[model samples]
Target: MNGRGVITQICIIGAGPAGLLLGHLLRAEGIDCVVLERHTPDYVLGRIRAGVLERVTVDLMERLGLDARLKAEGLVHDGFNLTDGERLIRIDIAGLTGQHVTVYGQTELTRDLMDARHGRGLEVVYEAADVALHDIESDAPFVTYLKDGVQHRVDARIIVGCDGFHGPSRKAIPVSVGKEYEREYPFGWLGILADVPPCNHELIYANHARGFALASQRSETRSRYYIDVPLTERVEDWPDERIWDELAIRLGPQAAAHITRGPSIEKSIAPLRSYVFAPMRHGSLLLCGDAAHIVPPTGAKGLNLAASDVHYAAEALTAFFRRGDNDAIPAYSDRALARVWKAERFSWSLTRLMHRFPEDGPFERAMQVAELDYIASSRAAQTSIAENYVGLPV
Candidate 1:
């Protein structure tokens, strides 16, 4: 509220889960920080995102004592299934890894974090327009943005970019300083959200002869489903009945029989991509979440990866502020990227396994069938998939 500018130890760009989670963690440690977002609170909550919660994500919520609703409402999934149109190959994550994932919507998780902000004394500035990063390579970093037609600057020892891929924070880094890595898929996921019971209690990732389809749910009554479509496909071309009919065909008989078709509340087609930017840190600026990397939604790693990044960034920032451990700040990039790469690999592998590529011939199709067969027959294969699905140790 200072007329000149605001001063804090850390300035977070983006009030998404990644940014807000980092803000909460730092606040718990008695650190002073401010979060800036280009959108309104409602806009942030309206973004439909991945629903699966890895243990790392749930743990962070538990640590903040923000799991009251999450624990009561979140569905604990012991395992999920992978099918090849005919048979269901189950990966018993709880039995194999002694761990499970929670089916909690990213929107609800963000809401939990947002609701706790005022009570916890966390400062988040929404509708922060034209936000930009400045002097990131220097010892002192800061951010500037316009709020309510007033220009303001926030001075901080560190500025974390939770602002996401399209945000100004990542663009602030000179192209010469960062190496970009990306892979764009030939197809996109056409998703539909409806107020209907899911076809299955557990998630089913199906690889049919036609294409890939995933059956997922946010709650007992709310369902989300997706089918891989050519990048050229448009949402307008597929109506509710068309989607449901396609889902019935692709998800196989078991799922189709139980599917309760209803009008879609939300529907969209999102192209898939695997992207990573090297050395997530440059001088005083550190990147977290989508600003650092993006994983295809195949393995449900998008939001979970962001939570892991925030976990690392929070630890590093807390160390620097409390113990004056200079090494943690410089080492944050390596620490976070270690896990990021693994999640990226899993997502990529799953996407490849389930989706039928445009260029893929009979040989490629045969290989996918062979791999699914191997995974179905081998306990070791199931174990590896289970371990990754539940997420690796943070």
Candidate 2:
């Protein structure tokens, strides 16, 4: 195949939530763009991801004109549980924050974005191989990528690295221009998705002597559950029955009684980490989502954070193109980082407050109990937790 280069205003790498949403939003604003993904469409759809949507995420989807299916199919969760074996504390999101989170799988949301893109005949190059960035420091930046063993190029006014942690975009930014901050936990969450109905109406996060366990769901009948495991643990080591048994012990008797065990459709171990790359822009190339930061799953902030990044990027890029405004570009990085750090703090605080750290001693464990006790009894603490859970702002 012979290649003739394509040119556009914005060339986005990685068709994940951030890239696709930004692409769709830019199109709605009459900005020209294209998206590239290293994975095939089916592979992207099959990936299992969390679904607790902050009110802002829901609003963004509605603005994209993709909320019809989400509204009809998603579950509205007014509250979630935080437990310490002997007791459970439910933070009423609606009562305290005047907002309710919606439970809709990330897979479903991505599918909606994909469908919207296709309906508008937007281009997304799938299975892009060996993608690379060029001349990001100059006004004219471009992308070179391989597709079906053939080389192709996209020259654009701006390039976005919505690509992920391991993607080339951040690496393309010289280390001198950016600083990276990261923390890797000693344990990982071993999660599973099963077809059985969820045990409760809302998600449950339990802290026990053994470890942390969570009961979450994708839909009314499709359940998701996870248990914290040492870094040495493997999915092969956790048979279905063993996982169910451990979940019961950690969640204690009351929540365990409602458990419905079934064969898992998907299972994996995800290591926890908190990471942020500062100054998310390097000239014409900017980073978003995992390409810029990562939060532990404890606060369910990963996907929501990605959506917010897209929100900021879409607005900034639109203004830049429409009015020749240069301010929103640099401002986007600073503004997004402020919120990213707050989310990092929330995830870090929650992880420490709930999980049984390998190095935690008696006093550390007591701190967990004390904090949970206070949160359970104090309305102020509950409100604080509820506001963060529902998201702070844009």
Candidate 3:
């Protein structure tokens, strides 16, 4: 609301879940912030994402006053089934770890955050064009962008980049200071979103001779499913009926028998990649969520990881603002990465166990089956898997 543009204590880039949630947390602490998003609110809402909510993620939502809608509409899953071609094994996460995950669509969660933010008369500028960062390593960092054919600038004490992978925030980190490590899977997921009842009440992840297929849901009447395909595959390559037929074959008769196939309202192929950037904080710029790291969708850690990052950033910022002691601010990257690496390991391991790697030999495949079998038979193994699925302490 300042004359120069939107001056505030913090200027967050990208109004996705991470940015929005960070804004809400900061505002709750009486900190001033403005969110800048490149896409329209409707476009942001139109995006589809994983629906799994970790225990910690749910706790964070409760703190943000967003748990009521989630509790009322979200499905609580005690366990889920994992299949390795023939036999299906159920992992009782709730029983093993005393915790469970919530099946709530990221879209709905994001909408809730947006609603809460807007209802409080907070600022979230949509269609922010050509977002650029200036002197982030300096004490006086600022942000500039175009809106309504006019350029705007904001002088901010701290800049938070909650933008996704392709966002400029990470790219602005100066190559010398930012070191990126990435691993791209040779395969991608061809996922479908349909307005039909899910095949099962809980998610079923199956690995068949053909490939990997997952049966998931966003709501009681809406289903989200996915099948593994080559990186070169496109959504056009898999028609609606073809996808259903493939799912039926891959999921096997046990789960597929109840599948209610219908016209897909949305369909796309998502490429999987495990990426992370070192020292998420440099100068006054701090990266959160996808801006710092990315995980494969298999472990459902993407959103959860983002939530953890925002948690650390918000807490550190609060300390700096309240006590004027900024020691914790510099340790943000280390604190966030400790958990980031753990989540990354979990996601990577799960993806390897439940997917048919193109280059996996018989030995590799045997090890995967052996690990799955151990988890199915051993209480210790099950507890380990359950703990990771339910989420580690933030």
Candidate 4:
């Protein structure tokens, strides 16, 4: 101990979006916090996968004056395209919900948050640290970590675990009372970011006899595309030519103009899955972001859900620090789970509608097409999509 004090105001684990954003929020409220991340700054900023930003995410960033970089570099999409080989259906999200999805990568989001934290002179410990939490029952709980080859103990009033799915925070919860819901699809997305312009004005989610293909953009010059492949397929098995050939076939001839095979800046496999853990809090170790739940990328809810988690966690912490009341803290899991489940459902629905199931017969295929047609034609169905896509009223 440096003898500065026996306890810190707050300690946040994982410097991902949730952890970084929570640190920023708490700092804004004059609360001091230390963020410990297992990965280095470079690794965290570059190694993570990309994701879409929902309208609510934009709103929150704007509110925090953190939208400058996002607005400058992000692509704003009005809607998405659902196609079945020859015919295309465009669901205009702006017209339907008065909001649009932003094509900002999760890595960019992490960079922005990291920048904001640094701009405010916040302390974020990157690289492997001996992070361990103890004395949760005490008024002053503590986190012990190593930095610069030296062990340091931080006694904090509260520890907010914003570390993602693989973090240690969730394990700290002894016999969690809530249920776990999860689904792992047989297919995984082979995502590639290339130095090519997008083939379409909006995202194209194609359901084909071969597999699923998604056409999205990162910027005016860079395109992000994905093809559904066997989960067992390795990235090393896919060469540049093979990847483009698959994309060309699934995207149809219109994609030929924009699908130039160039040096890929990024390529990785994203497994399709939906997961949730009830009651996001266990004592002072409150789980947020992927630490508590994860959703398939089909609905573009992963990063948005993380932001939402931080939002609720911040509010709860504010209430606790201000009033000494535990109501918000206890209700944290319930409140977050409501939206988590909604996103889970929406992601599953979207995945089912756009991906061809291996076991589906003709009847199931017809029903899926009919459901798509209904969504495109029915005002009520469109409104439901709009609400969920734009975000559930925050």
After best superposition, candidate 2 residue 341: deviation in angstroms?
0.5
C-alpha-based local distance difference test score of model 1: 0.95
Question: What are the Cα lDDT values of the candidates?
Answer: 0.95, 0.92, 0.91, 0.82
Model 1, position 315: C-alpha lDDT score: 93
> lDDT ranking from best to worst?
1, 2, 3, 4
TM-score of predicted structure 3: 0.98
Please give the RMSD of candidate 4 to the true structure. Answer: 2.1
User: lDDT by residue for model 3 over 266-326, one digit each (tens)?
Assistant: 9999999999999899999999999889999999999999999988998999998877867
Instruction: Give a tens-digit lDDT track for model 4, residues 22-51.
Output: 888887777788888988888888864655
Candidate number with the higher lDDT (1 or 3): 1
Q: Write the per-residue lDDT of candidate 1 for residues 19-121, one digit (tens) a residue.
A: 9999999999999999999999999999999999999999999999999999999999999999997799999999999999999999999999999999999
Q: Which stretches of candidate 2 lie over 4 Å from their true place?
A: none
Write down the TM-score of every candidate: 0.99, 0.99, 0.98, 0.94
Q: What are the C-alpha RMSDs, in order, of all predicted structures?
A: 1.1, 0.9, 1.5, 2.1
lDDT of 2 by residue, 1-394 (tens): 6477999999999998888888888988889998999999999888898799988788889998899999999999999999898797899999998889999999999999998887866789999999999999999999999988789999999999999899999999998989989999999999989999998899999999889999999988999999999999989999999999999999889889999999999999999999999999989988999999999999999999998998989989999999899898878899899899999999999999989998889999888888988998899999999999989898
Query: Which model scores highest in lDDT?
Result: 1
Residue 133 lDDT, candidate 3, scale 0-100: 97
Candidate 2 RMSD computed on C-alpha atoms after optimal superposition onto the true structure:
0.9
Off by over 4 Å in 1: 1-3
